[model samples]
Target chain A: MTDNNSGFSDTKQEIMQATYDAIQQHGYAGLTIQSIADNFGKSKAALHYHYDTKEDILAAFLNYLLSEFRETIQIDEDSSPEQQLLDLVDVLLYGPDNSSSEEIFQMQTALLEIQSQSPHKQLYRDQFTQIYHWLGNLFVEIINNGIAENVFRDVNAHLTAQHLLLIIVGGILNRHTTNSEMSPDQIREIVTAQFLPYLKK
Target chain B: MTDNNSGFSDTKQEIMQATYDAIQQHGYAGLTIQSIADNFGKSKAALHYHYDTKEDILAAFLNYLLSEFRETIQIDEDSSPEQQLLDLVDVLLYGPDNSSSEEIFQMQTALLEIQSQSPHKQLYRDQFTQIYHWLGNLFVEIINNGIAENVFRDVNAHLTAQHLLLIIVGGILNRHTTNSEMSPDQIREIVTAQFLPYLKK
Candidate 1:
């Protein structure tokens, strides 16, 4: 039973990796089931057995990304609430240390493309909704913790969270959409200097 | 010469209006030169005579939108800087009174889709960059005026403008992408309560 479960997980990872590679090479608009299969190093029929359409595979890829994001931003109990919040912002903007800035930008552009389709595609909308909720909840948790610890000012956690979420979302969109000149470090500095003071005790 | 110029501007307005209608009906992804022509109530050949490809017409459409945006968010000399800034935010989120929320959302979704393509389309990228600059400059002007008039705290106008831009951009993306439950009023309240305090004296 353990072996079967491990194998199933392995296959899922492979599919996700293939999807990532295909997207990196062909972009979201240019990607196809066959292209993903090419990256998978397997027959298109094998990929077809798993996902009937490109959207199905892409939906699965979104799930994979969500799980990956969940793992990447796992809250460290040892860190201060403030640190955790900042780290969350860092990951959202610059991505994990393993990925280069260009790679992060590429993936973000592709995600934005998929997001644009969300209004028309229920599957994409559902995944994006989950992502939004998860991020908002994380911010709320950190801010609430900070308040409890007496490290942050007494503020409306939900409202603050919403504000942070908006800034982050806007930063990402502006960065890629307009080819913004603001570096990630510059953004961090802006947040710290302009925004964090209001929250900090 | 004046009559000729008027006729030329009238034709451009017609083309822009038709492009807007086509995008509204078919969306960015589904949009085609033929669809735009169908909405124009003109022959495809007429459109082709002016613009060789869909991209060309869309690029012109973007320019038209930018001009319309500039006109819609015109700064009133009589209003206080604070009022101007707030009004700008209102226009960004809810759009002009002439358009319904559903219409605005549909247009935003289509714009997001085109923005997602900006990375690949230089014309789109240029237009978006110009739009970003125009918006940012408007914010800077308002903030600077507020500071000079003693209505706002002494702050870095550029940084404040950037933050506001980020929030505005983020709010729009979140409102559409997540189908956020936060109504325009709720968003306005949050912005008023959480963000505006930092700016006012």
Candidate 2:
């Protein structure tokens, strides 16, 4: 019984990995159950049994990313706001190197495409809102801590957090679109130098 | 003959304006040369005489924007880097609001649809390169200013500028792709706060 269940779980994982790879190579425009099934040498019915549709697969991918990000970021309740914010930056700018550019690109393109289509639009919206709220709260925590320590200004925390997310996300988006020749380290250095000086110590 | 030529030029401008308006109202999906001519009560042949094809009209619209932006920026040959950078930002962020949501949507959709299509692709690429180069130069100017003034850290100014441009352009692309509830004002505020802090003394 244990062996059978483990084999089933392994197949699901393999299916997901295959889907991610397909998205990376062909983009959202080319992703389909048939393609994924062919990659796995399985029937379309088998792929459907695992994931009802393309949205189901995409949602699973997003959820997997969310989980992975959560695992990467370890928010300590006792850490100072400065430390927390720095940690946040570290996670975003220099977290797991395992994340591929292709995967990120595929995910972004898929999410954008999904947002335009109905039914799935609402689902994407909900997922996006959750991500934003999580990000906003993290900023709020850091800003409040910074304020308490007399290292930050009496400015609006929500606004600051919102802007921080924009900068980081905007930076990633820019990196992909322009094909900027900077290495990842170089990109991080520029961002830190530009952003850190604004921190009122 | 001179008077007649000037009258013809005026009519051409009117037709272009009407074409722009038609694109905004009907979207590129529904936009046609006949419709544009019909909007202005002009013959299709007349429109064709001015613009060889619909693609020509789009190119002209982009050119008009670039030329207007060039005229709007009060360029000083001897201005300091900081001043020039600020001027560049003002130009990019505060240009006359010539773009409506519908028009932008139409242009974006049509462009994406024709992204790989020949002839149109070349036209798009030409305008794209012009904009990219202009943006890149603006960044170089800022970085050079920072070096001369010693206000900025001794960082790779060109790469940094490229990165900054990427973020700005990325944010614009995101707005087009997602059509999220985020307003331009909200985005601009965030970008300004993140970017301006780095430029401070």
Candidate 3:
């Protein structure tokens, strides 16, 4: 019975992977359950067995993404708070190092499309809220840790975190939405240089 | 002949107003040409007579919005650069003083939805690109003026402007996407306190 349950879990994981691939290829606007099934290498009937509608599968996909993001962004307690903060920003801005630029761009576009729908979709809004809260808490914790260690100046940790969150979120949106001329590396350098000085003692 | 031309311009402007009202009421997701026609107080045939399709109407609406934005955000040449900058940020964040909170929120939700569709729609993308460029240039000009007037530090005007733009755009997105506890006035105060000090010499 344990083995059967494990197999079932693996199939669900496969479905999530297929959904990601489908969104990347077709974009959220073009995405359909059939497209996800096509990516899954399964029949539409099989997909319908697990999810009744595209929104149902997409909602599950958001949960899957949040868990994956939580797993991936494991902050190192051993590292200095400053380094941890920079690393977190890097992850948010540049995404995974393994993914090609084209892949990252396509994924960002798909995510923005989903984000645009969040206002109308409660499932997406709930997941995004949770994600934002998780990120904000991480930032606050790091800032507080830095202050405690006497490595950073005294600052309103909550306010500072909100400021940083604004930049990070804005940077991600601007990348796809605006006709930005600066490369990602340029933006990272600018953000680091311009903002970090204010935090130092 | 001039009267006939003026009448033509008036009808187009009226159509744009109807589109705006429709989007605010139904949101971009639920918006249809018929809905716009309903707001227009005209038959669908009249709307079709003016524009062939929904996308065409929306494209024209985007242009109308851009022109209206340009007219609305007029920076006073006589004001201090610092005040000009703050006023611009206020306009972007809080919108016009006349609009109610609910109306502003609904308009933002609709705009974000349209922005999300930008990647797939060239017409929308072009308009957004133009809008961003216009906003960025305005920031750069104000920053440069501040530096020249000895009111601000000798910061890289281009980079500094980009940073400010990131915050502004991000703040707007966060208001709708995240479950932020901060009120608009609170955020305005926080942003002004945290970021402005860095610019002063």
- Backbone clashes per model, in order? 0, 0, 0
Each candidate's fnat: 0.79, 0.18, 0.65
Give lDDT for model 3: 0.81
Sort by TM-score, best first.
1, 3, 2
Q: Model 1's A-chain: what TM-score?
A: 0.91
Q: What fraction of native interface contacts is shared by candidate 1?
A: 0.79
Task: Note the residue pairs that clash in candidate 1.
Answer: none
Which structure among the candidates has the greatest TM-score?
1
**Over the stretch B60-139, how does candidate 3's per-residue lDDT look in tens digits?**
88778777877778899999998999999888777788888888888878888787787778888788788888888999
| Cα lDDT tens digits for candidate 3, A1-201 | 112222237778888889999988888888998899999899999999998988888888877877777767878899998899998988887786677787878877888878778777888877778888888899999999999999988999988888888887777787777556446776686568777777878
Over 4 Å off in model 3, which ranges?
Answer: A1-8, B1-8
TM-score of 3: 0.91
Q: Per-prediction DockQ, in order?
A: 0.73, 0.22, 0.66
Which candidate model has the greater TM-score, 1 or 3?
A: 1
List residue ranges in candidate 1 displaced over 4 A.
A1-8, B1-8
lDDT of 2 at A55: 78
Top candidate (DockQ): 1
